[model samples]
Target chain A: MFGLETGFGEFFTNYQYPVMIIIGLTLIYLGIAKKMEPLLLVPIGLGVILVNLPWPGEGLMAYEVLNSSTGLLETIPYQDYVQPPYNMAGGEPVGLMSRIFHYGLSWEIMPPLIFLGLGALTDFGPVIANPKTLLLGAGAQFGVYFAMIVAFGLGAAGLGWFDFQMGEAASIGIIGGADGPTTIFVTNRLAPTILGATAVAAYSYMALVPIIQPPIIKLFTSKKQRQIYMKPQLRAVSNREKIIFPLMATIIIILLVPASAPLVGSFMLGNLLLVSGVTDRLSITAGGGFMNVLTILLGVAVGAQMSGFIFLQQKTLGIFALGLVAFMAATAFGVILAQIMNLFSKTKINPMIGAAGVSAVPMASRVVQRMGQKENPRNFLLMHAMGPNIAGVIGTAVAAGVFISMIG
Target chain B: MAEEIIEAPMVGKIIEVMAKVGEKIAEGDVVCTLESMKMENPLVSPIDGTVKEIKVAAGDTVQAGAEIAVIE
Candidate 1:
């Protein structure tokens, strides 16, 4: 009775905003129920739940919530209905989760750790297979640059909504590269302030690749082009060639764009285990335990920031919308570029492989294989797409390098 | 007179030669096979061409974009 008033205890005991709780719960539902990138979304839902509850651990519990948004779900633990600071004589406040949101997300330790995890999980196999696909990856980066200009224009036009300095805008714009890691890397360096928004934009867009890319691809490819029968070429890459690839890549990419070394290094290291053939144990470990752990950690770390305050901005919405556009533009751009190459070359490129030009790696390649089968069931586009799929990875890395050198 | 020459897309050992020097073919006809990535890829002719030469026999590794045959 003396220590805990029912109202104060009530505010401290439960979620203040039922809608927000449901939103957090909704993420969990999507992650688990619908299976939309569950590896990331599940942890995010848990983080959302943790950050929203009324507790000292939430950082901003010191503030009073007379009529805040979270007050909607204020749970009561005691028998006494002693009202809050407004109604009672001198009761404590109801801003527990608000405080947590302030400290946990806005403070900036989480997103970078997420990046570290993203770095640890990545593989450079696709990039290594087709080094020339790097250019297509770079070409796809046109979305980043284009988005930056748009961000800058919006900033000047009074939509100064995002804390987006030119550097921050550039970082945010990298979502167009269809590269989550690079966006994290760039934003973490240039515009640390917008880390949460940028991360959300990247992950969300990545999850939507299948939906976003197909429409864009269909728009660019006609029935004839889609049905064009390009006989598959078998690539006989030697163990020696595969082993030497990571080393040659490290040398060339590092020399050409030193800034990419960190991401390129770790990514290639993961792939090296896979291709070296001498370390089955190591390959399995990297591809399994190491990869899974990083993915889980990355999801949680990213979700750690999506609490109510910062995520509610109009710019956040803008980033999501623009990221979608960028993804499409990149896919289409890669396909058209490949089509142009087809015009000049004796050998025809399966335009379906062009869709893999975005650096989502095996995911994009898998998408290509599925679509290629849809058009022609006998056509196995996975390995062929792997050439450009991996190329896209290198391309994105090189683009990241160019961005970092100019702006880092 | 043949106007086409087929080439390798990657460096690999020619595990099998399916076509002969005078074989007439259509587009995407398997002219030779290169074993790479542990799969035998039919070095298909890009167009209707006569196999002018069997450049390499079994156990030969050719570089990427190397000419495997010519057709005209």
Candidate 2:
């Protein structure tokens, strides 16, 4: 019998494999035990582990190369693969995860599809009821540009510590929007190489919105500001208004930023399906099973991209640091804007609702609700915060469109 | 006594009903927890009163403006 040798020795040869595996396991634990973004994190964690594991044959992310001499296909590590149109003819992507990443992300199919699902699930009533909240959402985008300037400045300073191009800076800056799909959409277009880092940072920070947003909300606003209460009920929005919102928004946004058509169009289409009261079946599927499948594919593909060699780098650290700065700055700007708005408005607005402008959806709004409750139990700011919460989505999508138009 | 009806703030599932019929509750007291958009939102009482009627039970799906409970 032939002696079968286990590939255990590969761990010693490449220490990064073990380190990456541990990181993968930590993400899994956080997802399952802590219940933190389990839908995305679980698949991402598993993908990381799968790609980093020792394999005697071609790896999960291996690229296929056609060997002319032997007239056969040969597999090479993804990092070693060269861009197409320059490399030898007949070469193709062969790995399962690699193909998904290429088709779903590189071809720019997943993000828009994900937005469709999100749109079906979202209710634009809050934003329609309170139009001024749109400005608050726009205010949160200050962090995106602020971080971009800092990142560009650092890179231009000639400091060897960091080097980022305009596209890369834009990709990193979108992390401030606190919208996961937007970050992925922007990064996949602007800097595919940093997609894994930016996606992970965006999702992780989004999950940590409850923790990340409060300090900044409290730091800028005093107890009195935090306790400022608005009317408990907003003027009831009619279905007619709800139906008109998506159509008008799509037309207006697409006109302003043509590049945003894909993201905005898909989002509005989903919203139309939900509100039209005529596409129940399509709405259910878009927001349900279809979205789930896309999410799994997206999560795993993103995770597979985080190979030890690509993810374990000095640049990855810089991306994470810049992402944090983006989130903090976005929160601060939102709060400051609300405070400024109060100077002119008659009805008082809880400054904390401005923090929800980062578009973490219900999470950021929930943080505002909790902090509002802490300040005064009588304050029910969830619905009010939701105004800006939903607006953040549109705001981020517009910011992404601007980036793509200017730099993409 | 004036009757005050608590309405579901948003569309969601009634995860848990914390208030009982005829139970004395204070204004702002959480009467039930509504799970909407994957977030647990507590439906609080609008005025200090006794719970006159519980209109919905746990696991019931609700729509925005649906009456949740009637307090007197």
Candidate 3:
């Protein structure tokens, strides 16, 4: 249908697709050259490219789908899919990624499975040995609520030029947790429309943990506070204790926050497999084999959701900016809470370890360790930092539960 | 000579056994590695001593406080 009369030149009219392709290339470059969460980034980067391509073909991303009733193959109209009538349920997926995304993400299957793998790989001993770190985890969750209010304020006041509803606000707020799966799970449930932008913001900030946390932690802590030493050796936890922990934690979390049960349940089940000592094959598969495969699928599916028209909105930029604020606020709250804890306690805790409670797991904890070592060479805070680090995972999940319960 | 019994700190399968009968070892030397919670935790010698006996082999499951080795 494209002769001079039909104007094939209209294909090149909107140049945003080219700009999005360059953005995709930048993400791939960052993953490969910068080594920034490459496991998630590489697949997501490729998906961005696939979804941005303008030309349509069979099995290609953005492929033409047959309108079943009319029996005519039609291109995906951005207007049809961008707003409330997503047509996800009605349309047949014409691309591989579209099919995967339809079944995996929209169905809400991927995030919980990823959490299961994370649980199998996690060590809860550090958290158990130091229960007080649970407060640091809880304290860090302040960022989520704080960001929610900020987003609400922006939308209500019309200052930030974005109108986020309650669900979208709650979803945007979760970026502070620094736990990608929990963020995805909450966003998927609460704000499916903004999932792509929010997921990208959450993961990007997580990858930038090493860069983002140090300055914030340093700003809040003095040299003397940073140099505080924590004992490397943790009291040995018994097998019976380890065996009972997952069940106990699950029961307590479910009883207290029923909404959090899905995420906490998946995570604790994985930990149970690891700690039970009877499920070796299951543990190995959950931690190693299955986890790797799921990461690729989750990354690609999430990336594919970010089609140029949907992702290039002014609201997406607002979400990214607010997401950074939430992250910084979460880190600040964790450290400040630790400093407050020092006032009442006899055995001093390193305030720097408090910063690890942002739930990026070992990355945030490692930053604390490095910062502690810089201030006091003899200070070994890695083990201590892990206590709050793991607790932050639970804290973020609980926070997501709270949001879901109140808002969703 | 006095004998000391080194016990398992947690219930886990032994993935590695570094202790040997009649081998002299320093304090803090790892005697074996245990797999627990998906992490490999090493059981270290509490005191410098000569390894008198190893009670478990690699792949053996042991409970907390179960004797792993006897050092003299």
Candidate 4:
């Protein structure tokens, strides 16, 4: 009686749900077969499937009402649950992913925690040894600004593609960062509605970094520039220098960009644990258990945001299209700027390394290494590429801080 | 005189040992290199001395402040 009405009857009303389920299956297929960030895509794909299933409005993935004063999650009244604008804020969550998103993501705790783990795992020595790579990282952020301006312009022109507000533009722009945690953090704050599309786009593009970066790198650099060799030996950093670097960087960067304090603070704390050498247990925990748990929660929450009605939009398609351009633009800008730097500097760097400045971590750097080796077997650019690769991570966080400072 | 021991400066794997037992080395010489988070950190001698013992070998994981070598 109640079951068929909720299942078959409800399914007939919105044909989009079935289609979304197919899309979810496609994500699962791609994750399993293509190995495209399976850790994230698998959970996200399952989340999509779970949320899209036909159920009563107050069922599992739907927003259940909460009493603010009593601090209890309550069932939403049938009328309110079925009405438009189902996402009422300022309530405790009953659903698992909702609670995770509300407490972890909305409160801005999970992303920084993820960054802490990343910091604990990251090697900053390459960036320290080659300071100039920081500029390449900064240059790669041109795509973020470029994408924002373009998004805002399209919205202003009323082109039917999208009409993004300032916050929405900022959220969309961060897809260029190619850093998943930072993108989600920024989107959660700026435009929660588009969080699913933006996160999916960001992660999807990040997974495709090897596919996305090489063409842009080739477009920007000549074969000679790609094959240019720089010595791989890095000056050994001392323990004192390593210990001092994170502290100094956090202090100086936060002073300059106060808004980045949360992200940079957590990141530096993780780095401190690693470099201080006195906190092996804490470092291992941060890098291993903590990161894994947070990644799962974050992935599921992001996928849960892809509820059928929210994700099936022309604007969603636009976000995906623009995301690709943003990633390519970031990669191109980094390579082109590296070529420009070569004109003024005595020691020329392999321009292939510049494409690694997109914060996709070792993937972007590995692409550079592979491409370099393909050109010349003697070339080992992984460490060299890592400098800019790691620099891109910091640069993206700094950009997010700047955006939050100006727009939030 | 106080006995001296070279301690690991950070948590990492001992990738290479730069000093050998019974070898005389000056202050600031690298005793061993530790690889952590994909970057190499060099453990240095605080005082000039002959290496008395090598406490850790290549491929061994070490904790920060753990004794890696002894010099006297």
**Fnat per predicted structure, each in turn:** 0.06, 0.24, 0.00, 0.00
lDDT of each residue in A225-327, candidate 4, tens digit only: 8888666466676888888889998999899999888898889899999989999899999999999999899887787778777788799988998888888
Candidate 1 C-alpha lDDT tens digits along A1-408:
566533346344544434446767887887788777777767767765554444433332233323233444343311111334222222243444333333433343333333333433444444445555555556666666777777767776766454356776677667877776677677766765456677767766777777788877788787667766654455445777777877787788899889877767666666666677787686677666765665565555555445444455677776766667667777888888777777887767677678888877567776776677567544556567766766676677667767778877
Off by over 4 Å in 3: A1-11, A57-79, A84-92, B1-72
- The true-versus-predicted C-alpha distance at residue A356 of model 3, in Å, is 0.7
Worst 10 residues of 4 chain A by lDDT: A77-86
| lDDT, candidate 3, B1-72, per-residue tens | 778787765567899999888999887778888764344666767678999999999999987668989988
Q: Which has the higher lDDT value, candidate number 1 or candidate number 3?
A: 3
Ranking by DockQ: 2, 1, 3, 4
Error of 1 at B14 (Å): 26
Backbone clash pairs for candidate 3 read none
For lDDT, candidate 1 versus 2, the one ahead is: 2
In CAPRI terms, where does candidate 1 land?
Answer: incorrect
Off by over 4 Å in 2: A1-6, A54-58, A65-74, A82-91, B1-8, B11-35, B42-72
TM-score of chain A of 2: 0.94
Q: Which residue pairs in model 4 clash with each other?
A: none
TM-score of 1: 0.69
- Per-candidate Cα lDDT values, in order, are 0.63, 0.88, 0.82, 0.82
Compute DockQ for each candidate against the true complex. Answer: 0.08, 0.34, 0.06, 0.03
Query: What lDDT tens digits, residue by residue, belong to model 2 across residues B1-72?
Result: 899998876678999999999899999899999887777778788799999999999999998778999999
